[model samples]
Target: MRSLIVTEFMSLDGVIDSPGGGSYPHAGWTFKDVQMDEAAYDIKGREQQEAGAMLIGRVSYDEFAPVWPTMEEFAEYNAMPKYVVSTTLTDPQWHNTTVLRSLDEVAELKQGEGGPILVHGSATLAQGLAAAGLVDRYHLLVFPLLLGGGRRLFATEVADKQRLTLAEHATYRNGVQLAVYDVLR
Candidate 1:
């Protein structure tokens, strides 16, 4: 079965809201020029190579649809199958985009013989997927600073306690730590 992998950048305080430019006070903190080597690029390259499709919520889809298709760097993601889980998203103008309205549909997509269903920037959808025990892996890149006031990644919206096992860990010179966890059943 294909895996549902979540990848997000967060502050030390677990704030995953608006890593890019947005309304958050420390919005663009993540992209600031920190010392990153080839290992960092390797991680990103690996994720893209392993991803068969991308699973995202309406908010993420809205954020990405307009910009990603235009970027030469994200051509791989644009070419891959993209699934947006939304009730209101009726038409997707981006190439290879598909709107999935239900959790069942998301689950069904996971059963496909693909590499991985990569999910990014879907906080509410991540919570829902966590509650349903559908998230297979979480790749969290934790920055050195603390936001103290933005939306958190591990919220209490989950229905029950779910444990996680650390599968991978890597630390960057600029204090960004990549922690990969497997959702334990």
Candidate 2:
């Protein structure tokens, strides 16, 4: 079975919204507040290299589909098969993209042949997957500052508690920390 990994650029307060600048008032907080060095993004590069496929929510797919295909840095992601969870999305314009209607489809995808499937910037999808106990691991880049209010990584109303084991961790000079955890099954 393939592992489903959720990756996010999160804040100290667990806010995962608008890290790359969107409609949020505190948009672009990740680049603005943190004094990031090249090393701070090493994990991101490694994720791209290691990921066998990409999974995202409709919102994240909308955000990334138009841009990632044009960037050299995101070539790996562009080339990999991508699955977007959406009930409304009819046709996807991005290459190698497939629309999955529910989490059951995602679970089925996990059971199929593949390596680790990485989830990026799909906050709602990640939350759903976590709550459903479908997420196998998390790769979080925790920034030092807090936005006070925004969409968070963890949901408050999850039915059960998830136990995690720290697989790896690293602190960058910019005060950004990489925390990799494996969800205990």
Candidate 3:
């Protein structure tokens, strides 16, 4: 089976929302002071090469679908297949998109042939996937500042405990801690 990897940008206090400039009070907090370093660029390049398809939630898909297609940096990501997890979302205008209505559909998608399924910025769906033991890895870039409050990566009590093995880690000059974890099944 292809690996399902979840990547997130978080704050010191665990806030993950509005990193890409949503309506949240602390929106765009990530870009306030941090610039992309060599290490960060390397990681992004590596993920772009390895990810065959993107598995994301409705909200994140909505956010990315509109902007990424127009950005030069996101050209490759726009070309790759996108699987949006949503019950209310349909008729995706983005090229190479498949709207999935449930986690069962997501599981079915996982069984198909591909490289790693990259999950980005879909905290709720990702948490559901984690609970279902579908997540294979987690790549979190934790920033130094705290937002006091916002949506978190794991905001609720999961029914089961999921242990992770540290796979890789690094700290950038801009105070972003890049932590990679392998989810133990």
Clashing pairs in model 2, backbone N/Cα/C closer than 3 A: none
Compared with the true structure, what per-residue lDDT tens digits does model 3 show for residues 1-185? Answer: 88999988889888899887989998998887577566765677788888999988999988988898998877768889999988898699999999998899988988989899999887798889998889999988898887888888885677898899999999988888989999886
How big is the positional error of residue 122 in model 3, measured in Å on the Cα after superposition? 1.9
Q: Cα deviation of 76 in candidate 1 (Å)?
A: 0.9
Best TM-score among the predictions, by candidate number: 2
Of the two candidates 2 and 3, the one with more favorable lDDT, higher being better, is: 2
Tens digit of lDDT per residue, candidate 1, span 28-143?
Answer: 77776355455654666788888999989998898889898999988889899999999999989989999999998999988879889888997889888887888999998888
Question: How does residue 107 of candidate 1 score in lDDT?
Answer: 90
Query: Order the candidates by TM-score, highest first — what do you get?
Result: 2, 3, 1
Candidate 3 lDDT for residue 18 = 88
Candidate 3 deviant stretches above 4 angstroms: none
> What's the lDDT for all of these models?
0.85, 0.92, 0.87
List the candidate 2 regions with Cα displacement exceeding 4 Å.
none
